[model samples]
Target: MEKPVHHFSELFEQLGLASDPDSIERFIQRNAPLPETMPLAEAPCWNEGQAEFLKEAVDEDADWAEVVDHLDASMHKAQ
Candidate 1:
């Protein structure tokens, strides 16, 4: 079985996003944060596939659920 993704870095890698530390840091700094209450599937920041993946993790509470939830909260918090 594949290992679970516990950190944002691994989650990003799983989602085929920018997993590089510098890129992830810059992404966090550059983008507008999503609202805490917003559905990740409906977030403006995600592409359709990325949104679907996040939604699936949340809706099904899959192995990636914890990481997805953490991402949701982290992406919503202001610096």
Candidate 2:
């Protein structure tokens, strides 16, 4: 079977963060422009559990990987 697709809100919820659209937007705005040299999992904003989850998702290429990449790109966007 194929893996279940996930949305930005779901990814945020998985990270134990606010999952609503407005909250998600605000979060991205607040944390945008993550350093190009810094990995998403290494960003200071995430707590240990959230950081571990992001790292594993990317490392394992799990079902959550796409959305996690989206979040990383969103964070790295030009402000």
**Which candidate wins on lDDT?**
2
Q: TM-score for every candidate vs. truth?
A: 0.79, 0.96
lDDT of 1 by residue, 1-79 (tens): 8756578788888778789889887776665477767775677777888889899988998888988887777677887
- lDDT against the true structure, per candidate, is 0.79, 0.94
Each candidate: RMSD: 2.4, 0.6
Runs in model 1 lying further than 4 Å from the true structure = 1-5
Worst 10 residues of 2 by lDDT: 28-37
lDDT value, residue 45 of candidate 1: 73
